[model samples]
Target: MAQYSPQYEMNRYINHYFTSHACPPQETQAWFSTPYAMMNYCQQNRIGAILPERFLQAMGIAKGYCELEPPLRLPCYLVYKKDNPKYATIQVFVDYIRRVYHIKK
Candidate 1:
């Protein structure tokens, strides 16, 4: 499996998924920091990739990559200063994000 290096936030979750699953161990064929590069490589080489939904959307599904069923669920959290004076704007942004992702904070 292809492994991403350079330590992006998603890398932690990807690592966790691999370690927790019974799938074959990931032997790094290439280290890609960005989703585009990894998606391109996977497409050209006929290899499977673990990519985020945003990346897949950006790359276009017409590339003929089959999305596995029951998408990988990664836990996420939104954190902010509770005592900050500009809490309203933060709350609005947080609410927008929750709506987009369909998640509760």
Candidate 2:
């Protein structure tokens, strides 16, 4: 089987979570900005990923229990709507993820 990159797995998790929750795809982009940002939001909000530990392990990410560089992304859209200023901040993160991780619709 082809192993997915940590970033790719994170994208799938985000997409699945938002879609299952009936969130529009556009709204999803507005929600997390990027996978890394989403992870940060999850950490802050106690919203673990589908396979929280596994996902983190795959990404080489560590949370409160581990000693690692804190992920440097933010979930601006998690607390605001698309029309809000924070949404723009999220959009920047999303763009970065897309460019850096090659996330596609």
Candidate 3:
């Protein structure tokens, strides 16, 4: 179990899950700040990493990692300042993203 920054939501989720699941010390041996670093470490060490599914897809090696039972889901959100003047442009961009990703508000 490689550790990422405590600030990232994914890291928080991973930490919470691991605390309840009680991973062995051997499994929780490394720490890194980015997905790329974690992925590279896992590859070189022949270990598994708890990474965003998209990361694996982006690396073109989704099949390389062994996925565990009971997959994790992370919630995503789009946020902006309510007082911003570029509301229309932001809405258009948001709409484009939703359409591209098939997301519903």
Candidate 4:
């Protein structure tokens, strides 16, 4: 098995779901250096939905639509068919977080 650094693990986690509009080299580096901060920002920005959506889509939850269990009360629907909706959503979330939290990473 290959030995992985903390930075490498953080990068893998972030890039697995999030992609930048431009190159993400700087952002990736920042995330590697401050994974906890990145996670805190995500929590503050209410990004928990992003992961569920990604997982549902990966499990064949119809294009543009997600299935939510009861008690959660999340609105799930088929909005549109896109090639990379998860990536797009992630980018939007990133932008929102950056703007709302003054993130400079």
Candidate 5:
């Protein structure tokens, strides 16, 4: 099988999925440093590629299109001053996040 291989920088202590030195390099068809690259490649080449759905979706992508449900689920947080974190930029970001996660106002 010709699948993709991970090229994570450091893996001495923690070898998460991406940084993990697993998959065969010779079998790797191509490399993607970002989720967009992975997704665009799969879409353009019509070949499936493993992707980090959390990061991708956090950046905002349409839901139900390629919904990914990774086994290792992690909690997402939006930290702010809370007192007056409602700057224009923060508001815009919060709005975008809300839209992405379908959070109710």
Candidate 6:
């Protein structure tokens, strides 16, 4: 399989998906800087990828997608670190996130 580089948000999203659900593991053979690059690699190699639907549409990739038996709703996140004392209660926000995502440990 080919996919986005480790630093890519899509990579993180996919990781979260697999971590929270049951699915066969896909071994990656290549990492690309962009989804388009991954798509090209998959096409040339006759392989598959985990490209997001939004990206496919944005890239104008004319392909059909078979929806998962039950579709999943993935959340987007925004995060930052700050030294401001006012933000010291961030743990409450963190704990809320953990509960919402059902993250253990």
The TM-score leader among the candidates is 3
Better of 2 and 3 by lDDT: 3
- Show where candidate 4 strays beyond 4 Å: 1-85
- Residues 1-105 of candidate 1: C-alpha lDDT, one tens digit per residue: 565774777777777666677656667788888777888888788576788766677657655666645467877677788998989999998889899989765
Residues 1-105, candidate 2: write the lDDT tens digits.
111244554566555655666767532222443546667666677444333455577788665444223322323333457787678788887788778967674
What is the lDDT of every predicted structure here?
0.74, 0.52, 0.77, 0.43, 0.54, 0.74
**Tens digit per residue, CA lDDT, model 3, 33-94:** 88999989988895667887777998898576667456666677878997789988999999
Structure candidate 2, residue pairs in collision: 33-94
lDDT of 4 by residue, 42-97 (tens): 54653322234544555564564345332222322335446665978866776787
Q: Please, what's the RMSD in Å of model 4? A: 17.4
User: What local lDDT score does residue 92 receive in model 4, on the 0 to 100 scale?
Assistant: 78
RMSD of each: 3.3, 14.2, 3.2, 17.4, 7.9, 7.1
Which one wins by lDDT: 2 or 5? 5
TM-score of each: 0.65, 0.26, 0.69, 0.20, 0.36, 0.56
Q: How many Å off is the CA of 5 in candidate 2?
A: 28
In terms of lDDT, the poorest run of 10 residues in model 5 is 9-18
Kindly list the per-residue Cα lDDT of model 5 for residues 33-61, writing each as its tens digit.
Answer: 65566677766774655555665577676
Better of 4 and 5 by TM-score: 5
Superposed by TM-score, candidate 2 places the C-alpha of residue 104 at a distance from the truth, in angstroms, of 3.2
| Candidates 2 and 6, the one with greater TM-score | 6
